[model samples]
Target: MAPGVGGAITGAAAGKFFSWLLESERARPPRVFVSFDFDNDQQLKHLLIGQTKRQNLPFSVVDGSLKEAAPEPRWKEAALKEIRRCDVVVVLVGRYTYKAPGVLAEIAMARSEGKPVVQLIGSRSLGYTRVKGAGKVLAWTQDNLTKLFGND
Candidate 1:
């Protein structure tokens, strides 16, 4: 075989190998617990969630859009349970997040459970306040999402 042909075959084989590796990494979508101030940040949270779904990102939000109809104590219990099941927690930090007791509690629970926490600050106007146990605090963007969840 010609040397150029041999080099081409080798390059094709390497490309195929890397492609397979990337696919394998994407196969197991991580379970994510998203903690946000539902009352104040719902729209932004929904937008992020929608983008993830539309883009077929490599992660699943364990907490669906279900409202917490239960009382505060029971709701916290349920939220903690969901957080425990997830591999990571994404906290949507907005201006009202510090004032939202439930959001703070969720972040605390995630920390107690040893789940990795990724904080997504919705706006610069909100002023960034790092969550107690956040592993990363980043602006809301697809590139930041990729940083947390890996390239899709």
Candidate 2:
């Protein structure tokens, strides 16, 4: 090997090195798209949004969640666009989440886009239902959230 030639990463090696750096343990915080039963779970969504401002959370909630009670036509299209830009979709499961057409539609959109979905138990009610097919409903804990978004 020529002197100093082996000292630097170049070409394919450089590309690989860069990739490794990006995928390393210190990868950027995952962008999260939050979904919830807007009719009854707005406060829960806001609670999660508040966590983004803290430095200890593992993910950053992306803006552009639908805030209106009555979505205009093509709202799903807008939702899908936002979902596509995020790393994961977090559905805040609530009492009426299953009955929330918008939440269900958002979940379907996330699934169709191949985005990972994380279901968090956002309600303390006795019969708060989970969003079907969204996988397990996990507790609202920093540890669990970190495990999901920490290195992804």
Candidate 3:
């Protein structure tokens, strides 16, 4: 092997190694999309939002009420787009949430996209209809969420 050529190869390797090292160190976390029945309860939305912020998870809450205008049915398409882009989908189900059309649509879309869907049945028992097709159902509490997703 040529001595000078060896130095060039080694220098190139070191430069590439350092670049990857820095990139990994500063990498952004994956996003999670939170879906819940907007008509269900204010307290649930507030708690979920607070938990997301506290954990520093990149996320967007899909609440139609927060927007300035009424949501079109196509908004489901937009919302699912966000869900597909995210690494995880968190479905919070209260009594009202389970019965809400929007929440049902969101859950089905998320499942269709093959995203990891975690169903949180909070403080409420779901009727057989609501529980029938759920792939994974977990406790609706914050602690259970931490368990499923891993605490940050």
Candidate 4:
């Protein structure tokens, strides 16, 4: 076999070998699925949402006319489906709001799905408890998250 192909096969074998070693800890840390909008909340939502996109990991966000004056229940279904598919759910909490009721529902659904949760706060507004299974809640500024995630 050519050297390149030989190296490729060897690397694949090594990868598979290492993958098997971590099979027992599959439930730890977990895959993260994030939810938010770009234009709607801007800062908080944008920060976490932006970092997720930059990471190139598998994640989904609310899309389409869900931002309409009156949202359809189907939007909730779609969002929950994404939340259900992930092992972790990260939400962005922002200001000038009572909080996004829909996103909150998504978090609850993630809990129902047995996914750990994480949140990055975009504002200083207080008066909420971290979700029970959430891993970490960071006071992340939108710009800082963008830079830290290397999306800046």
Which of the numbered candidates is closest to the native, going by highest lDDT? 2
Error of 4 at 110 (Å): 0.7
The residue-by-residue lDDT of candidate 4 on 9-120, one tens digit each, is 9999999988987764453334456654333465555555566667653334433224444554787776676666555566655442225565666767777878766676
lDDT of each: 0.79, 0.82, 0.66, 0.56
Candidate 1 error regions (>4 Å): 1-27, 64-69, 125-128
Ranking by lDDT: 2, 1, 3, 4
Q: For each candidate, how many residue pairs have backbone atoms clashing (under 3 Å)?
A: 0, 0, 0, 0
lDDT of candidate 3 over 16-132, digit per residue (tens)? 999999787446454567776666555666787787777744434444333432466667767877877776777766766657776667778878988877777665544422433
Candidate 2: Cα lDDT at 10:
60
The candidate with the higher lDDT, 1 or 2, is 2
* Clash number for candidate 3: 0
How does residue 16 of candidate 2 score in lDDT?
A: 89
Could you tell me how far off, in angstroms, the CA of residue 133 lies in candidate 3 after the best superposition? 3.0
In candidate 2, which residue pairs get closer than 3 Å at backbone N, Cα or C atoms, i.e. clash? none
Candidate 3, residue 36: how far the Cα is off, in Å: 1.1
lDDT of 3: 0.66
Candidate 3: where are CA atoms >4 Å away?
Answer: 1-28, 54-71, 125-131
- Summarize candidate 2's per-residue lDDT along 60-138 as a digit string, tens digits: 8986566674555567878889999998999988888877888888888889999999899886764687678787789
Best by TM-score: 2
Model 4 TM-score on a 0 to 1 scale: 0.51
Error of 4 at 91 (Å): 1.4
From the highest TM-score down, the ranking of the candidates is 2, 1, 3, 4
